[model samples]
Target: MQQDRMEARTAGWGQRQGWGRRADGLARAGRRPRRVAMGAMLLVAGIAWTAQTLGANTTPVCKLSVCWASEADKLRYECDSGCYFESNPVDVEPEAVCNVMAEATHEGSFSYMYRDSVNLVTTGIGNLLASVDDAVALPFMIEENGVSRRATEQEIRDAYNGLSSQSAECIAGNPRRCNTANSYAGENALRLEEDTINQLCQTRLANEFTPGLHRIYPDFDSYPSKVQAALYDMVYNLGEGGLSPPKWPSFNRAMGRKDWQGAADESNRPQLGTTRNDYVRDLLESAADEEEAGRQRLASCASPGFP
Candidate 1:
């Protein structure tokens, strides 16, 4: 069934004919485009193998078409169903990461600017606009007399300043208070489109948090999806520096040794709600279960076949 699905999806690309003709011409010229050929073969085989080995219930991580210009380009980057791959392949499903973050950050309520707990201007799943420049960098929509238009730099700056100057009490769990006519509502109201918010989140994860995660956890890509998500959550919630060895020594030590349960025990944060803490702990525990199952599988494989 998985192979059938894969074949059905690839059928359209195969029918393009242009690719076939190009391949043929290159072959006839004795420059066989081996990398393209090899990449195509690997992509199909890899997807099939991954689906089979991980079981039908498992989500395929790399379902996007391979569009690399060369083998070197392939090595440097690859696109996935929901995220862009960097130099190192992201093992955890990008959708899973996004779901975890969206839930933890905004609970699926994205759009509109608001001040966070610390009275810092924020929007779109905890995206912080620390300065007026930060606010102006992204596109924001402003509504005037029921018509929406793109906000100018001055409007964005004014909104940022207005939100930034609000009292902590007004911002503490009161987004509506922060969005009054004076600040982010009516003529002064500024909002981000959902697509822009999602793009912003993805770009940050790909460029900032994920790379920092790889530096601290060299074997990150080899971990189970749950483990990777848990670690990624930590890196996202707390910046890379906040979760690094110096800041989180115990947790870092547990992670270094692949002690999922130990990491779970050390993963609690006073600032985060209990639900969020429990979510991280549960993910780590689930990873511990996966680790134990893997150990049992290896042990069974090592036993004599005729025993």
Candidate 2:
């Protein structure tokens, strides 16, 4: 949210701040003031970079004065000392990035237990409870007489078992709309708050999905945001192994070559809905368009000009 807020503020400033006259005045001024201004600018840039590097919302356990060349280097030193970084540096904030995947996986829903298409007992944004331990690990709340309290382990186990026992027909027929209708829509239905669901999704993205994606695509951070999101969605839907070579050979080849259109052509997943498939395709195509536009801009900049 801090990143989102910062982007909005930057956009507003861009509209009002005309840099032409200020730049000209600064140029006219002595070189000393310009040097000082440049120093100030660099300092501000460093702060912004640091904020982005360590998730804006996350507080680092320890601070290091030494500069590191990459996030991996920073993590190696920091994590060795039991320090925790919220996430790796990404084009988009971790929370916003998770939201993109959540939209496709859970469709803006964040409460109540249900069954996924494959009949897995799931809750809050497609979070799967493979066993009773998984259910008890999460702090699920239950409501009674208009009051909310944390659900006991037995209550959680009961709810999970209730959903797990549902027939495949039930799962297919009713996916259980979030916050509205569910298999157990009675007095003490187990639920998770929106913030809790977001944290769960974000944690998985940061700890599991993102690290796995990085291992597969080593230069993942360098890719365009849309491409990154597309790859992220793939990894989330189909585990890291599912997107690697031998499993998705054609897609892997296209990605290796940085061929956005080729990758888009190979991105279809028969099991997923057309809308989700289209979203991934569109992201890849959009990246291709951006790459083409960048090339055109470079060419124009290099051309001989009378001015």
Candidate 3:
């Protein structure tokens, strides 16, 4: 039946129908609505059978150093002595580390210009423009310059140069924006402010979104890191309120069931035209593959009472 649907897709008939050679339409035809509906039905049926046989919500036992708990309705694991339950994926991994690709992605879409059309100077990978009131609120903003004025372009450059090398390079076209020892010391005040602001955002995001995600998906930890990261990005960008059913019904529906592909489709809607959904889907699959390989290696090692 699936094969019949595959064969019935209209893309292959494009040439015969003189629809030109740009068959980009066929590129993602596998995601046809009917096919997705059928696949979802099969998955639900399988899960239902498994639940009936194994009992409802019976999570598998945990291994060493992994403990599960529910908070604000989210199921999470406290691992390696860290309370890494529900938090924005961006916060899970530092902006400097996690979602590097996503940030770079925005650079391409938004361009690497110093300032936007509105004359807001940019700095970081997401271009962290000065136009955002939050940027002004960044602790790096100096009040007692004795002049009691907004930071000048030079001051902004000096402040950012001290804290983030990667972002500074992207912004200033110089990897060593603050190379000299004296140069570094000169920006000490600004650097302190930058660190404070960074910490503030992290704290705020964790407090705001962590419990909300817990409420949205109780078994959040069981989800692939990529999926968690994507969800974090969504909430971070749109806020918990914006991520609700009225704003993103399909994403909410697919995500509620851990249907990553379906969720990806919902995220990759044509109107949005963003690669975030596909990126997360790929990351999740890649992470799963790596884990499977690690398990296979461990199994091989454990043969004959451990090598």
Candidate 4:
């Protein structure tokens, strides 16, 4: 009886060991496939991320080639194939800064004309009558409903036709003539005026200053957007031609040298007065400082790699 009990006990032990080994092998087999699937998923995700990064780097870059729309084609379109200026919708970064500065300096008005504090015949935001003789220039485009685009010539012509002799007269204190005497000055006329002013402001900057700046600095995009804004205002106040020659030789020289502070100081000259010169200088420097700080912050940070 003792010998039979020993043999039976040994057989049961062998069967248990065999079952344990099979279970361990099955678990390892299941885990192998799980590990491979996880690695495959990671590889695919890495490839997609790399592709996205390359696409972002490949976005189209633009630079102004033509100065302004020719008399033959007074209107310019956005994001078109040609040079940056001829392309529709100017560069997003600098254009925003320019628009804000201009809007702040010049008030929006429809058929409203007055002698600015500087005693210039000014109409609309940044449309100096002293600089541009006609309120409406040809080949100008207006976006319908203030959002979508409308035909350039027809809209401008309609706005022009709506005007009477009174609206046409944009002289000093007699600005009220359009308010009372004209059939225009309604919502439609105001929309047209706003469109015209916006277009002209952009065109003048493209035509006059952008190309020269781009030529001088390869990394012109890195410059403070406010500098572009200030320059545009200068163009608006003083014609593009006026930026050079007898009036601002020092300022022009400083700009040619890429001397930002020197240009700012030249801009702050007392002759132009604190209102025009100081205001613009502050705008330019502050914008530059802001852009620099943003760049620094980006440089200091580490990339947050794919989760």
Candidate 5:
């Protein structure tokens, strides 16, 4: 039946009765309605399956150390939910250093990026890769002795706080960010601020979050992927400390149980300065540009990954 459908699709694409070349109309004729119906069916079926198989369809992807990216662990950086972390298909021996990630049910997760190996060297077990370059694939080769597996909840908390803590230095006592090393430099502060706003929207607000991004910002329904890409780029550009989401200190104020007045007050601190004021103002405007750029980017074939 699938073969018949394929053949029909192939023949349906040939030129029509009168036209010299195959027009979209002719190509779409027999296959159009079926394809449309098929697509609808698949959507419904997929959604139903997802709902039944995975409740809520929210909070996608498990948060593990590997799910995070960091300077320390090569495989840990941007590690998806499996034993393998590399992108390009490569070979590895059976179990070694990295254990194939399994669910609580003890079932293995499947990934297009992962494949079974045969007769490959088992020195490192190479089951889970971290990163891959042109010559070698996965970061399993980068392992050392002191590394630990599966981050503890304390580690997760510590990691999150530790990473987030660095934001203050740039935004700390130095309003100008002039003394700060990573502060966006020179006349580009406007661009820097705009970028920072986007960053705020992502990491602090969104984080290069795993699996589902659309859930957090339902407001971005019209431009799901675009807003996500913009948000990540912004977070990357702006430190997680200041300049995004609630815009940092204000964000911390709220986190610290400060009321709306305090939050708004902290948020408004930039208004007190010309340079900082100009930066925020430009960022709001830049968001529109970033959104449009995001739309164009989302429209393209590119799937925006983390910054």
Candidate 6:
């Protein structure tokens, strides 16, 4: 009886041990597949993230391939190209994108005209262009700063059109306001924008001055050409109302009538008895200092960045 009991107990222990080993093997096999699956999922996620990043940066230049009904034969399209300025429905459409690109050519080919609104002052072609170049030229880019910027070709044209409209509204087309003496007054003087420059130059500056500033500056008594440029900078800073012109009534009447001292006196007055006398004093003194320096350090600072 004792031998039989011992044999049964031994068999039972062996059976228990075999069952435990089988369970351990099964658990390891299940864990290995789950680890492989988790690794595969992680790899897929990484690849997807990398792909998305690349897609975001790249702008597909569709060379007339994604051509919509409204697109031109040679139009170039990029990401969201037809959405803004060129769509047919005035929404995102095919023609709209083509129009956007077409606008670039027009703006590039178009002339830059700059004018002052305060005195109805308009700049000469040379001066206008140089100023515009000073504002906009930077390798292949032009920064608008507080002003709006058009990144693509379409954007440039859109900005040009919008500003052109503003120019029309600002100018009442007052002939006296457009005069070189008075026309070169507020707009361009105050607003150193492409549109303001264009209005002052194209509308009045081009037509208003006899030969532009050359015509007017020579008439100024005792005022040198360098001084005239300085005065314009002054005008740009201060309005026509702010202008004193060294006894201007006497100066204008004398253009050759007043003589040098008359114009100089009006220009150099310590007080004008109008507006903020203190402010006027500072402006006049600053402009004079810049002129006396006989270099472009101050004048360059006067205008804003890019038209």
Which one is best on TM-score?
Answer: 2
Which residue pairs come into collision in candidate 1? 184-189
**Tens digit of per-residue lDDT, candidate 3, span 193-307:** 4344345445545576656766676655445455666776666555578776677887777766555556766675332325655655565454434434433443443256431
**Predicted structure 3, TM vs. truth:** 0.41
For model 6, residues 99-149, the per-residue Cα lDDT tens digits are: 221232111112323343331212322233333333343111234665534
Candidate 5 ranges beyond 4 A from true positions: 1-34, 37-41, 44-223, 239-244, 248-307
Decide which is better by TM-score, 1 or 3. 1
CA lDDT of each prediction against the hidden true structure: 0.61, 0.61, 0.41, 0.43, 0.26, 0.30
Instruction: Give candidate 2's TM-score.
Output: 0.65
Query: What is residue 287's positional error in candidate 2, in angstroms?
Result: 0.3
Please provide, for model 1 over 14-66, each residue's C-alpha lDDT reduced to its tens digit, 9 standing for 90 to 100: 21324434666787898855444223434444543121122232222232233
Give the Å error, residue 302, model 1.
4.0
Candidate 4 residue spans exceeding 4 A from truth: 1-98, 101-104, 107-122, 128-193, 208-222, 269-276, 287-307
Q: Estimate each model's TM-score.
A: 0.64, 0.65, 0.41, 0.40, 0.20, 0.23
> Which is the better candidate, 1 or 6, if ranked by lDDT?
1
Ranking of candidates on TM-score, top first: 2, 1, 3, 4, 6, 5
lDDT of 5 by residue, 221-250 (tens): 222122223332223234343343455654
Q: What shift in Å separates residue 247 of candidate 6 from its native position after superposition?
A: 15
**Residue 237 in model 6: shift from native, Å?**
8.3
Q: Measured by C-alpha RMSD in angstroms, how accurate is candidate 4?
A: 26.0
Expressed as tens digits, the lDDT of each residue in 41-120 for candidate 2 is: 22233232121122232222222222244544544444333233222222345676668766744244557776566566
What is the alpha-carbon lDDT for the whole of candidate 4?
0.43
lDDT of 4 at 221: 49
Q: Against the hidden true structure, what lDDT does model 3 obtain?
A: 0.41
